[model samples]
Structure formats: structure tokens, C-alpha cells
Target: MAPSNRPIRIAGCSGSASDRRHAMAMLAANCAHDPIDVIIGDWMSEGNMTGRAALKAEAMPAYEPTFLKSLEPALLDIAKHKIKVAVNAGASDTQLLHSVVVKMVRSKNLHLSVAWISGDEVLPAILDAKARKESPFENICTGEVLEEWKFEPLYAQAYLGGLGIAAAFARGADIVICGRVSDASPVIGAAYWWHRWQRSDLDFLANAFVAGHLIECSSYVCGGNFTGFKALESKGWEDIGYPIAEISASGAVVITKNKGSGGEVSVHTCTSQLLYEIQGPWYFNSDVTAILDDVHFEQLSVNRVALRGVRSGLPPLTTKVGITAKGGYQAEMHWFLTGLDILPKARMLQSQILTLLAPHRSRFTKLTFTLNGTAAENATDQPAATVDFRVFAQAPCEEDLSPKRFFRPCFDVIMQGYPGATPHLDYRLGMPKAFYEYYVTLLPQAAVEHRLHSGDGRSLKVDPPRETRVWPRQQPSCAVTENGVRLGGFGRTVKGPLGWVVHARSGDKGSDANVGFWVRFRDEWDWLRTLLSVEAVKGLLGEEYNGKDIDRFELPKANAVHFLLHDHLDRGVSSTSSYDFLGKNVAEFLRSRHVDLPIKLLNRGKI
Candidate 1:
């Protein structure tokens, strides 16, 4: 098929593997009025890959079985429309998923050609590199040496480019299944194939990349996780629709949701997703590096936002690789302190717990006492007066957290604790559970064994991009000046939640947390840009700031300030003991902080 100038419509069906199964059917059912050229689904995540590895270890299918179930409702519509499908639900076993899907398609009497891309599994490659005394597995976030990781790496999956996916579509594939392609690869691949874009189409590729990122989270751009949920209260979120992207030949994309579906697709919703989990203003992909600092959004119509001015550069030579290993066992115990002296009761209990763990403390890799919640003065309800004091312990051996050693100490301390100390009383919730630790590092895109199994018996290799660029890994330093406005002289101040004036979105990247704050009005951006500094953020973080390194990036075009806090999640959600495991609460926490906002900007109404 030759490239066409007409816009290609791609509907985002799934965000993560567990996303609702209705989107695939929703788009297909509404196709007549809202004709879409392709359907894009994303099913891969950093933590899910490790779980898939464990399944492989058990001699079970590593692919997400839920994805297979998801295809059933859309099968007939897919055949009727001849819609091209692409997804990364193959996880650790692309071939197995391919066989299963092919079997399903044949049983349904449909002649849809399915392709599965491989070579995302790079554990053997990492081992071979280690044997050659090469260090390709250094921790990307902390710069820790491989020797320091200690745990044996069971599996490593490198993020592959979209070329393999694009090639699959080129080879008459009705569906493309991928193992560990970047999350945006499906949309980028489908766009590349639809547009017949070459490796040199950097600008087009980058544009598709951002569009994919925005809608890949499905309903997120349709008010799923929007900060302005109050506005969506009347819209009924029970069935918030999934997102869609209409990409033009020039690479500009218009983001919208399923036709007549609930929820929304406003500029704020689009920008909220645009800032999600991104490392910096420059987004790195195996095929292209997107310069997002210049990107802007324009609301074309209700529930329709156009992403514009996303320039591009050469492809990055390196892509992210996730190495998974046994992180050991972790357990937690919680106690409630109600009524008076919450902090004093928490301290007393902490001191007692430390005494109990003093003998076996060295056995634990991590020992933490976290006090959650605060008592309101003259509280009206019992729950309002209560605060939780949690003690978390992690060790290489599960036995270290056994009832006699860990829980017994916890139980014994209850009698000697504060006057109102009471256990949280959930045994299983506090029991030791095994988890995997993820080690991330950048590997050469050329090193990824990109392969395309085009529904034929042969598996063909997809070569690396012909042109690549070596961009600096470091983010540009923050500047105090923004629209030539100084921080102090802007306007009158008020002590209120920063959220009163700012909208924020946050997510996890490896072991770090990234939070993005943006303003509603153009003039507010000037004040926001000047008011928010690394120091200001540190103050806002308060107790959550554990003195870890933070990287700040200014996105003038998006009217956003992005902050990346290193080692914030204690090795990401897979093994973290954090209350907000995914870092989704980071933005909310920051927004809730009391700050001196300019009354001038605050009077414009909250974002």
C-alpha cells in the first residue's frame, strides 16, 4: 500500500494489560459514525514484565492471557473493517501468544494474519556481556555498579523500536504482537506503516510518538486520571471512554475520545498525559528523540485537542533495558494512634519497635517506620482522630519476617505502646511477600535483537536505524527567569493549597518519581515558572523529600514544571513499601501543600 495524505485514525484500546476490555468493542461498534483506520492497544509495563518472567520460569505462558480474552468481542468487527491491530501484550513470550491468537482466529474462520516480534528478551545477552567482562547493566538511575546489585538477574528485556512493528504491518499483517517494544511503539509503528514513513522521517515519527504517549493510557486523556475530575462528575465516570488520535501526514495529531462516550478530551486532559512519566523536555525513543519543550496544545472543539509544534531530532542510539531479579521478602505491621498526642504515640511505638528489632536489624535490607495521616483538632469522628504508624521490614530470607521474630515483636509491643495503641489487625496484609527488583540501564539500540515473525515460518531481523544521535543524558539546568518576571515582585500572596492554582500529574520511572505541575492561564505560567524552583519543590515535598537527588526541567510550551526525584519509590512499585506505590499521588501531595500563591493569579479561578 502506498502512503496517503489522508489522516489516519488510531483508537487506543488498552493502556495497561489490565485496562477494561470494552474499548476494543466500543471503537468497533461505533465505527460507522467514527471510522478509524487502525486500533492501537498497549499492554506492557515495567513491573508486569518481571511477573511474566516468573510465569516463564514456571513453564507457563508469559503473555498476558487477559489480552487474548480481550480480542474476542472485537473479532468480527476487526474482520469486517480490516482494521490493523498492534499491541505489546506478548510480554515475555511473543511466539506462544502468536500461536494462541492464530488458533483463535482460525477457529473463528477469519483469515487475519498475525505477526509477533521477538528478541526483546535480552537476559542471555546480558549474561554473555558479563562473561566478556563488559558492564552493560549498570543502574541507569543511581549509577550503581552491577556488582553492587548483588541479586542474580533472572531476565532482562530491552525496549525495542517501532521498526519491527512497522515491518510487520508492511508484510500484510492484520495484527502485530510485540514483546517489549516501547509503550508508544504500536501507534508509532501503525503510523509509520500507514504513512510509509522512512527511518529518516524524524519529525513525523516524533509527532506520532507523542500522540501515542498521550492516548496509550486510554481513558486518561478522557478524564480517567485528570485532576479536574470535579468537572467530570456530571459526565458519569463509570464508563469513561477511551482516547483516540487522528494523525495527519504532517505528524500533527488531534486527540479525541470514543464517539458519544462519557468523559472528555480537553487540552488539560491531553497535557496531563503529555507530562506523564516523561524524563525531561526531550523524550528519547529508539527511533526518535522528541523535543517537547516547544510542543503546545490547541482545543479545536469540545473533547478534541490538537497537539502542535512538536519538533524532532535524530534517533537516540540507546534505549532502556529492564533487568529483573529476586528482591527478597517484605512485610509490614501497622498500629493506630487515636485522640491525643499522635506524634508522641508514634515516637514511643517507634522506639519500642527499634528495641525489638535491634538484635535482628542487620538481617533486614530495609527497615522503616512511617507515620501516616494527621489528627484534626477537636475531631468529630473516631476515624478522623486516628493515625497509622506502620513498621515495614524487608530481608533476603522470608523466614526473617516469620511470626515469631517479626510479628511477635510487633504483637508484644502493642501492650507496651501508647495509651490508645491498637493494631491495624490485618494478618495477610502484613505477611511477608516476595517481589522482584528492577534494574534499568540504557543499551545500544543496535544491540537489541529486533525480529519480525510475519505470520510466516521465518523470523526476519529488523535492522537498526541508519542514522542515530548521541544526546546528553543530563537535563538542562533550571533558570530563575521566565518571561522576564522575578519571583517576589509579581503580586499579592495567599496561604492556600498550591493545587488551588495549579494542575499536576505524576508517575513512576524505574526507582524515581516524576511530577509535572501546570497552570491554566497563559499569564499564570509566568508566575508559576518563576515561583516553582527546586528549592521551592523541596519545601513543598516536606516529609516526603528524603534528600534524594532531584532533576528539574522547564517546559515553557506546556506551561509545566517537571521534577524527577531519584530513589523516591525505593526501587519502583514492584518492591516499594510506599503508600503511593505508583507515584500517582506525588502530584496530588505537591498540589495539596500550602503555598503563597499570588492573589492576582489565584483570582482567575482554580485550574
Candidate 2:
């Protein structure tokens, strides 16, 4: 497997652990029309990894089983085309998944060589830190020392680099399985191996890094979740095409999808993906640090977008490590309030709930009672005149939230209650379920045992980057400066949803939340940059921002404003009693907030 000057074409089939079921089949079926070298999927995340690890002790299949399901339908076509496959889907049990995949291939009489990359499971490293009198590392989101965590630790995994995956491919492995590598490591490894890239190929590696990030979420770059979803209506959404990246030896990339696929690839679609789940202009990776400030996208054709101008720098010595702990148990109850006096009814119901739980309130870790909006005024339909009263409670002990102590008492309220005290028809909502909290922190690459195990019993150790650069606690220079906000400058105004003039995408990073907003026009970008100052954004977030720190950055080329809200999701996904569990709807919520829109921009109509 020698290096070639030919461009390496890689495609993505899965975004998350629960991504579409036919993605692999769709991509593999179109291989005859648009041949690709490798098909990759990014299925590892804080929640997925911790959730899978929690099931290991129960003798459950802990690794991501959905990857096998996705790959099964396309196996024959993939085998016929000789396309390589790589994915970080072997969450916590790579060995088990590797054996399962090998057995599948053997049962089908396929000649694919399967290799697995392990050593990312770093619970031992954390235990050693605790054993040697060393203080636990500070949490990545809040900077609080891990010593403050009271729960018993469950699992820890250090994010691995792509070199091991590259080593596997170099050894002629057709399919590579990984445990907890970074989300983009599969694409990075495929490109690195295809071009015979070296450790010092910073700029080249950076291109692959950005390329991986672009397509790492599969159809996300093909209008799957684009704000311009109306455009996708005509383009077809049911089977939106997955993304493919064509990388030249010099590391330039062109993003495209299969011909006549049920999706459109444009600059806006790519830009939306570029702005998603990213903190600042400088996106870091284990192989190289990519400077996205100058990175730009150009719509080359109907379904092809060219990406370029990605500058690079030395790799970081550390990568993100996720630690999972048994937080406790959580339960939720949904009660609906219909028609008039919604506020008084909500207050009465809440008062009754609090009174009922007062005896065991001390056992509760957190209780979130939300009266989720009022019904429409004199509404036409019965459903429109109904609102949800939700109760989410978490406790360290199961008895605190048991049916008798919790649900039964609350259920008793209906008899002595507010006019229409309707609980969700399903009584199971109040049943306490075990939950795990995930803490993210930086781990030194040297502490990891990154290795590749190929067929024929050969093992290869992939070393860390030769040179590393240290980043400051805050990189203010990496972000663009915001001018003063002048509430009125564009024209005569009208109050409306921000979504009318802007498009947004948001997601979570551990307990922190990341949101990005962009406009369809350059004039709107001017107004957006000045209007969305850090203070303005904090104000827009309203209660969600409640004194939390925020990091704001601008991507001039992408015409977007990005904000990182620290510790906004409480204790990450598992323990947080939040409406937006993973903060995926933060941007949508902000977009729904009313704001003064200039008539001139309003004339352009909603995006």
C-alpha cells in the first residue's frame, strides 16, 4: 500500500450513535456512480461512551451495536467495491466489537482484514493519579478541581490520535475499529495514510482535520439540519445525501455528495456545519491546530462545495478526556394544564408538589419545576389551550424518588387539586432511573497507550506529535472584536423572531453550550456583528446565562458570531435537569426570542 498522488475520496455514513439506519447502505449503493476510498462514521460522544460503559458490568453488549446494523446492509456492496471502512464506534469494548465484526465477515466469506485500536480506556491513569497523592485535574468546563466530585468514578477515556488508525491502514487492514478516538480521527487517519503524511505535516494535516470536521456529522453538511430547511423541502429531506470529501495530496478538499441524491450541498450548508459545536476560530485537534478564521467555502456546482485557506499550527500536547461517575437516579413527571388561569393553576400545583416532597426534600440533589409557557389566548383548538407542567427530580438514593414517596404523593394531588390536574397518561414517567455524570478534562497524550492491533497478531504503537504548542487559558486574540451596540441604525424597525433575519446552529460540549448565528446577507452580517456583542448575547440567553461566563468569537469568512456558555447545562447531560438536555435547541430558543428587526432587512423576508 504505497502512497499515490491520486486524490483520496472519503465519505461519511453515520453522525452519532443513533444516526440514520440506511446511511451506509445509501453511500455504498452509489459507489458505482461515485467511487470513494473509505467510509467513516463518528459515533463516540460523552453521553454515548458513558452510557455504553454503564452497561458493561451487566454483561450487555457495551460497544455501539448500531454501527454493525448500519454496516450490515451495505456489506456486500462495500466488499465488491473494495472501499475501506473506519469508525470510532467500538465505544468502550473494542475487543468485543472487533471479534463480532470479524466473525460477521468470516460468516459471509468476505476477505476484509479487520483491525482494532485500543488503549484509550484510561481509568487506570486516573486511578494512578489518585493513588500517588496527586490532585485530580480541573474540570474542562468550569475549572473546578475534580477533587470536589463526590460520586464514585466509573470510567475514564483519553481521546486518542489518528496515527494508530493510520498504522492499521498501513498494515493493509481494510476495516479499522476504534474505542474513544476523537470524532474526526477516522477521517484524519484515512487521509494521513492515503497521502503518507508525516508528523510535521501541520498544514496538510490541518486540511484533513477541517475536512473531517466538515463531513464528520454525515448529512449535516448536506442540509440535514440546515436553518434553510425550506430549501431542503424541494431538495428532499427523507433520504438526504451524506457528505464526501475529495482530498488531493496537497490536502485541498472539495465537499460533495452523490449525484441526484436527495439533498443539496451549498456554501450555506457547509458554513452551518462549520459553525456547529465549535468554540472559537481556532479548532484544535490532536494532530494539528486548524485556524478557521480564513477558512472559506465556495459553491463550485449544484452539489459540490470547495473548502480552502485553512492555516495550521503545532499540535497540542493534551486532548480531552471524559470521566464517567454514577451520579444518582432521576425521574420526570409531566402534568398538563388546560385553559384559563394557567399561572395560578401552575402555582397551586407546584405548591402542592413542594408540600408533598417536603419530608424527603433533603434527600434530593436537585428539583426543577418548570411551567412551560401558557396556552394561547381564547384559542380555537383545545390542544392550543393546553400547556405542560413538567417536574424533573434527581436524588442520590432511589427511595427518595420511589413511586410511593414521590409519584404516589403527587398522584394524590389530582383528587384534592386544581380544576384539571392531568398527569401524562403513562405513569412510568415518575419511575426513577439510574444516571451517570460525565466530566471532561484535558489529559496529556503521553499518559495514553495508543496502539494498533492488526490481523496476524501484529501490534503497532503510534507515537504522539514530535512538537507541541501550549495554549493560554483564554485566547482573546483568536476572536474578532465587537463594536458597540447601537439598537437602531439599519432603518425603521418591527419586533419579530431573530430567526426571521438570521440562521443558527447549536450543540453542547460537556456542561458548556455552543451556539452560532449567521445572516444570509453581508449587510445583515454587519448588523449581526455589532448587535450580538457578548453582553447582547448574554442578554439574549436571559435566564440561561444567569451570570455564567461566555466566550465570544467571530468567523469573518463564515460570517457568523459564536458564543460558548460555560456550565450552562448544570452537571452535563446525565445529571442536568434541563429542558434542553444536550443544549441542541439553545439556538432555536434564542431565535424564538423577540427582537427589533429593521424594516429593510425584514423586507428580505425570513431565512
Candidate 3:
């Protein structure tokens, strides 16, 4: 029987900051009162994933598995209440993860709907997609080829928003489990399913889109990191409040937190989250036609905002896609050497570290120096150079050693360098200011033509079949299933062998690949690995991807896979400046992953 709206409650929990146990306990309490229709769990971050992969490669246990193992018990509790759930918990390991959740739900005799959003691995997707001549992606980081993208992906999240959630709900799955869905998508799915709204209902869709954005970052509204923390006091700090959206039929949202929890809900708090990563002027949603405008933040009550004036718009047939390619490994290190004239003191501090690093330069990839601290006025016209109060240092893996090793000098500085330097008085008490170094890469995205098809119905390895074929310039026929669509592409007829070059970008220097695959639809995500493992392209690229699950993939000459996602462009474009445009909301609903600082990074990287 289809679920008729009796005020269907959908709750999502992010596992980035808290453990799965905490999410489970909160779910247990919330479901006791209002048995929720859907529960979403998020637990992946690119930064965290990179670090974990590094740790795993080093054979050290830096990754936390509490969230990974806590799924069963939590689902069991939801099953006890006959509650359905969907979780973006395991990230790209959807197929292997699906069996686990399916078994758990069936064990309790509860129905379940599970899907994994695929195609975010820039490297694999590009090569595979290009080889199949399916929907292809391009590289963005380097104007050059990202061949390293052939490594197993570090992350593979396709950002399935309302569509996947609605599909899961339509299937009568008591629980919908996902690997990486946009935070607000589950709520949006529930609202769309309940209202039976058309894709063109821009106003209503916009309202629902606003609701998802407002409450997507649960803790933000509930006081996890509200800007005005000093103003509010929480009696039950032990248990924080989760967010809820009292969505009206017209799409207007009454954003609220759970009953009896610590946190203040005010216009300021809601506005802060809304504006957290707002970059572009417009904000978009999954429904394709929904666009937010004239977001009026009214403090109707404590922890409540009466949002109004959400507008919708027509959606393009295709959605906007994002393609991330292999940028080099970039890292930054920060050291807090607080003392008098910290600027000069830090300069000397930096020189000392550089002196040691210069000798072992080959170990490093790149090196950069910056000094930040409040300094007096120097009104010269040529730039008026006045250093910031704090000394800042940035080094890339290409120039300097690893970020970890680069920052190790801070310990040596505290122990001996600072003591021997002129600023004996500059030395503060406590440890030598443990300098923390940050590392990242600058990847690029390009555009490429592609196709979509059905799998050969031969194997189930959760990857693309390792098949090798020269995708033709002409469009190829494809097969679509109730589950999802398959993709194929053509490769250049290189002289060396029957193999093809999988280029991460369409440009002459783009990464080349011998194979590629573009798996569309959420249900078929489980078969992505097997699909990549096809016989034709087999032995062309290995299964074990690198740091990210969605490794470097090929893209069109100009844009990344995002160029192909133009179908739903209007959905991502925000209409009014008042509305908060956050990448996390967009990513959850659109890409299945919560992109931290996506709007900022996207703009900075110009993706």
C-alpha cells in the first residue's frame, strides 16, 4: 500500500562531526514520538576521505568505523517503529554496502528501498564514459591529462536528489538507504511524493527547495556552530536538537528543530546557515522547476522561521554536472608563534624552517611563504606592503615535502630554533605551537560528448565491465532498465594496440584512458564496478582507484561532466539574493555528497 500523508516526517543525520551512535540515539528518541518516514545518515567529507585514505595507505588506523558499524542497530530501532529510512552513509561503496542494509531490513521483515548515486569519479567516469561514447566528463585541474585518474576513485557520489528519494519511496521501501545523497533531498522527496507536484510547479517546488536548504545542516540550526552561541543556553546539552521541516502544501516551509533540545532558532541562526556558502546570485533545487527568490526570514517563534516568497522556474531537460580531475597535491601548514612584534618574529621563524627545508628540497614538491599579522601603516603606492598579524606558509607537494613533514619543523623550531633566535622573549609557553599543515589539489573540469546504455547483463562486480571498444563518432544505441541506464563511448584508434587513450579532458593534453563507462540512474550504482570490469576494456585500467572513489575521468574539451548536467540548470540557479545558496544542499540533492565549501571552492576553482 502506498503511504498516504499523515504528516510524514523525514529526518537526516550528518556523521561528519558526530558518531553514528549519537545519530541512532537521537533517532530512537525522535521515532518514539513521531515514527519518521525516512532517516538519512551522512558520513563522508573530501578532506576527511583524503586523510583517511592517506592513513590507510600508511597502514595506520586513522579512520573511525563507529559510524560504519552502527547502521544495523539504528535501522533495527527504526524497524521496531515500522519507520522507513535512507542513509548516505558508506559513500561510494554502495553495491557492497547494499547487501548489508538489505539483509538487515529483511531480517526485521521490513521493506527497504536502497540506491547509490554514481558517476562522480572524474578519472574513471571520463575514461569509461569516453570509451563507451556515453555521457562523458572532462578534466579541470590541469590543462593537461590526469592519467593518475585511472587509479581507483577516492569518492564516487552522483548527487541523487529528489528523484532517487522519490523512486525509493515509490517502490514501497520502508527504508531508503543511500551512500551519498544531498542532505535536503530526502525531505524534498517526501514533500514531492506527498504533494504529487509536477516538475513544473516552480513556486511550490521552490518553497520545498527552501525548506531543504534551511534544515539540511541539522546542527547549524540546533546550535552546533550558530554564530551567536553566547546568547543562547541549552539545558539539555547532552542531547542536541535535530532539524525538521513542517512543509505546507503550497511549498512554504516552517523550519523547526526537535522538541526539547539545546539551541536557539532565530532569524540570525537560520540566516547564517542560509548564507553559509552562498556565492552565486541564484539557488536551484532537484525538482527541475524549483527556484528560490525573495527569502523572507521571519522569527515567528523561538527556533521557528516563517519562510515566504519562494519562486519556481522551468527546468532544462538535462541537469548541470560537476567534473573534478586530478589537480596536484597541494598542502598548507600553519604555526602559531604568538609573541611581541609577531610579524618580524614569524619572519625569522619562517627563514629558519626554510633553511632546513632547502637542503631536503627534492623531498618536497612546492614551497611558498606568507606572513600574516596586524602591522602599522605603510602608505606606499606600490601595494603598501604590511604583513598580516600572523605568519602564514603554504607549500605544494610538487615543491616541498609532504605537508606532514613540512610542518614537522614547527616542533624543531620550538625545541631549538626559537630558543637560539633573537626573539627569546617571542617564545610563548606550552608546546612549540604545533604547526598544522593543510594539503589539497587543484583539479580542473572540461567538457566532452557521451552516450548512455544498458549493461551486458553478464556480471555483477559493482564496477564497469572491463570491455575495450572504439566508441564511434556517431551516436550509439543504448538500453534502459527499470533500475537504470548504461553508457558506452569511443576511443581513438591508437597504433600501439587495440587499446584507447582515456583522456581526463577533451583537450590534446587531457588524461587518456583505454576504457570508460557512464552508468546512469541510482539503482544500477551497485553494478558500476562490474560494468567497468567488462571484458572489452578489461586489463586496460585496474579496479583499485586512488585516494578518491571518483578518480580522474575524461571530460569535454571545455567543461567537466557538469557541462552535460545542463538539463536542470535552472534548478541550481538561485533567483533572489536573499535566499541562501549552499553547495551542501545542492550537492546532497543533486550529487548525493555534501560538498564542504563547495560554492566557495567552485567559484575559487572556477568549475
Candidate 4:
């Protein structure tokens, strides 16, 4: 299905900065491409949510000060273009968002229908169910029952999906406000409305999923956090290009930036983003499955990637839950120490430092000690020599003698306190810092669900919505068995003939692994068996390695061979044992065995 009018062109603004202003600016800048249907903006973060809650308590829009004020001119542009706007700028308060939007529409004399898509924030909803003595929603963060604890939420956003946006559109809303929706949700919603894609058309949904992944974070694929940002800046940062998505009915998405805009999109930039900040083989989505291996990016232009071969399979069985828990108290005290045996002296200082707080030590829930540029604790045969140190202590509860009081007192150690006790305390004062503790709980996707409603002119309402849950099964395991198949680390094995090298690489985070590889088309598995085998695969691993130590595998659902290797622990490259080095050996072995055929590696299965 094509758009009733022109393809219902839309623009998305990244959430990190002045989301509303940028979204408006993009629309205004591209005014020449008139009759744009929707403009989406995002401005939600943990901190932003908390800040917005505080503003609502004072009867203000949370984004009023920063976004609303900054985007006044842009909001005017919406009136001029009659462009529908969607944003999470309301943060924790959708009602407040609706009120603000209505007021702005009226003030601008724009005849725009406004709607606030709510119901994702299940904190209050779950709490209400709990008060009713029924099972409040189970924790999505962890599959366990909801723990009995006080929850002060500035925002409890449910990662809503396309259905929510469709309902907003159905309600004749020109503007929609959302809380925490998946970055892809807005794109999905827009595509769902424009193309009228069926819910069962999981393939198109998957295509939309890829499109959202590409452009959801805005400048990311357009050189914002590009690894080759240095080389791209010469093109011009003054007019940094924004990402664009050209989606078709077949669920194919071609990603490109606005023409003439700054920035370049290449294999490096696109591939870098493909694996950014991802944790597991399955890139979790609210509704559809986006098998990363099925997605391919071909450089169509300087800043374009022809994204094809994305096919949706059976949807995942679970939905992810986001839970935040209060952890403990953390205190950091930084000091400039100068002494003969400064390293040894720092060790002594930490002991002395702990002794000073012994009185209130009982109030602590947990204790940790750390130092910068020196070990906070040491073991030795003889009494430790003098050394300088900076120490930090953490506990479960920081309320009593914590952030405000206890941690700050450590700053005086060098002056009046430590000087009075030891002559070796000749060092500068330390900067005292206090930190709050936060813990995360992973609940099964089934634990948290949202209701969907069809608005009846007043407000669309859905209750006891479909259950959304994420199952936390152990990752799958891998094993290699053959006489001639050889493998080794990247360093040991330089070249291989028959074997394909699976190189381990780091994502831009420089912390997590974002490994991907192409699979030969001849490889096959029963789709039905693959669907049922993800959980069963673990059982297979358990049986094989009973009583042994192997943590987890990344077999989300397996039709093809899957492997994961932590980049840090691997020998230069994260690949199956010696299989990497056996490339040449395997080629020879297979040829000798009389199994011959032309073979090639691909980035994705097929486009």
C-alpha cells in the first residue's frame, strides 16, 4: 500500500539535545519539500524524566524551561506547515503534554488535533493493582515477583510500539505525545499509518524496525558519533545532514541523509551503528523480531546505505521490562597526597580514614574502598610504609551520614584531622563527592504489559492490555567436532582457505562486543525447529557440559550456526576455538574429502 498522498514524508529529531527545536528546524529547513505529514521529537532521559516530574509538581511542563522556550519559533512553524508533531518532550507527564499542546495550538491559531498517547507508565497502574490485592504486573526487569518497596517514580514509561501511534492517528490527532517508546516506534507508527501495513506483515514491520534503528538516534549514522568524524568534518558541520529512510512495501528500507546536508554515510559509519550498544544477538523490540544477520547495508551513495534483505520471522515470545531500584550509598573522597612512601602512605591513610568514621560505620549497609592512581588496600609481610591515597566508600543506604554529611567530612583529613594524628599527613585537601546507588532488576517480558484502546473522541483507552514479557533464558552454546577442521586465534592463524574468519570487534562504546558475520546460503534449518529450539538449545548445552562451567550462549533462535566471543577475553579475535585459524586447513581438508563448490561470505544472508 502506498501513501494516499505523496509518501507522507516525515522527519525525526534525536533525543539527546534540543529535540523539539531540532525537529522544528529540520521541518523549517526542508520547507521546500512541503506538505510533510509528521514531525517527531524526543527529549527523554532518566535525568530528564526526574526533572520533568519535579516541574509537574509545580504545575509546569517538565520541558517548559529548556524545550518549550527554545522551540517557540519551531512550534510556530508547525502552525505554518500544518505539520503534526509527536514528542516525548513531555517526559513523565502526557496529560501535561496534551494541555500544553492544546494551549500552543490555540495560541498559534492552528487547527491541529492533539492527542496524548498514554498507558505505558505502569508504575501507578501496577501499584493500583497491588493496592487492590491482585497481582500487580510482574517485574519485567526480572521475572521475579515485584518486591515490596517504596517506588518514587518521576517517569515509568512503557516502551510502546506502533499500535499506540496508530490509535493516536485514528483519534484524528495532529500531534501525539508519548513517554518512553522504542526509538523505532515513531518510525513504525508513521510507516504503519502511511503504508497501512498489516500487523501480520511482520516482514514490513521488520523493515520499519531496521529503518528506526538507522535513524532513531538522528545524527548517529550521519557522522555525529561516527568513528571517521574527523574525515567527515571537512564536508561541513555547519549543516550536518540528518538521516532519512526510504521504506517500500516489501519492507526494504534505504537509508540516506538529506541531499546537500553535511556528513557522509559509508560502510564504516553504517556498520558501526549496526552494532552500537547492543547486548545480545537479539536486538529486543516491543513487537517484531529484527534478526541482525538478516539485515544488510550497501553503500548506495556518499551518505546512503541500501538496507535490504530484512525479513521478519516469528515475533519474539517476550517483551523487555525496565526497572530501577535504589541500590546503596557511595562516597568518593579525592586527595592530593605528598609523602616519602606515598603509595604505602595512602594505604595507611585509608585505615586511618576508616577509623575516623568508625562511629557511624554501623549505619552503613555496604562498604567498598577504592583509590585513584594507587591501590587502596595492600598486603605485605612487614608493616606498610607511608603512601598517599584517595579513597571511596559505598553502602546500601546513604541517607544517614551520607551524601550531605558523612562523605563531605573526609575533605578535612589533610588539614585539622589527619595532621593532628600523624606527621606523615603532609598532603593537600581532598575533594569529597557523594554518589547515589541504583540497581536494575530484569523481569520477564510477560510481567509487564500495556492495554491498547480506540479513542471515542474524548480519550482513547485500553485496559488489561496484551501481556508483554521477555523471557531470560541462558544463551546457547557452541561446539566444534571434526577431524580436519582447524581453528586458532587471529594472531596465530594469519590466513585460512576453507574456513571463514569471524573477527571479534568492539562497538563504539569500547566496552561491549558487536560481532556479526555472514552465513553461507546453503546452510539450512527447519524454521519450526529453530523457533522451538532456542530454549531447548540450552538444555542441549546443559546435557553436554553437565557439572562444567560455561555461562551462556547467544542463540536467541537458531536456524543458522551462531557463535559469540567476548572481544576482551578472546585471543585478538572472538571466534570459535581454533576454527578461525583452520581456514586454510579446512579448505584443504574439504577438498581432499572431495566436497567441492564455489563459496563466498556475505554481510547478510541475502537482500
> Pairing residues by index, what is the TM-score of model 3?
0.57
- Candidate 3, residue 311: Cα displacement in angstroms equals 0.9
Those runs of model 3 whose alpha carbons end farther than 4 Å from true positions after fitting are: 5-7, 15-20, 32-35, 48-70, 106-125, 128-157, 234-238, 316-338, 368-416, 419-607
Point out where model 2 deviates above 4 Å: 1-3, 57-59, 133-135, 477-487
415-482 in candidate 1: lDDT tens per residue? 77789779977887578888888889877777778999988766789998888988886866573444
Give the TM-score comparing model 1 with the true structure, all chains together.
Answer: 0.96
TM-score of each: 0.96, 0.97, 0.57, 0.67
**lDDT of candidate model 1 versus the reference:** 0.85
Candidate 2 at residue 107, lDDT? Answer: 90
Q: Each candidate's root-mean-square deviation in Å?
A: 1.8, 1.7, 18.5, 11.3
Please provide, for model 3 over 375-427, each residue's C-alpha lDDT reduced to its tens digit, 9 standing for 90 to 100: 44554431243332222232333334343355455335655544224322332
Ordered by lDDT, highest first, the candidates read 1, 2, 4, 3
Runs with alpha carbons beyond 4 Å of true place in candidate 4? 5-8, 17-23, 33-37, 46-65, 124-145, 148-155, 237-240, 314-318, 324-331, 336-349, 366-399, 402-405, 415-457, 462-472, 475-607
Report the C-alpha lDDT of model 4 over 107-159, residue by residue, as the tens digit.
Answer: 98867676766655555554565577565444322223554544443334456
Q: Residue 56 in candidate 1 has what lDDT?
A: 81
User: Worst 10-residue stretch by lDDT in candidate 3?
Assistant: 501-510
Task: Flag clash pairs in model 1.
Answer: none
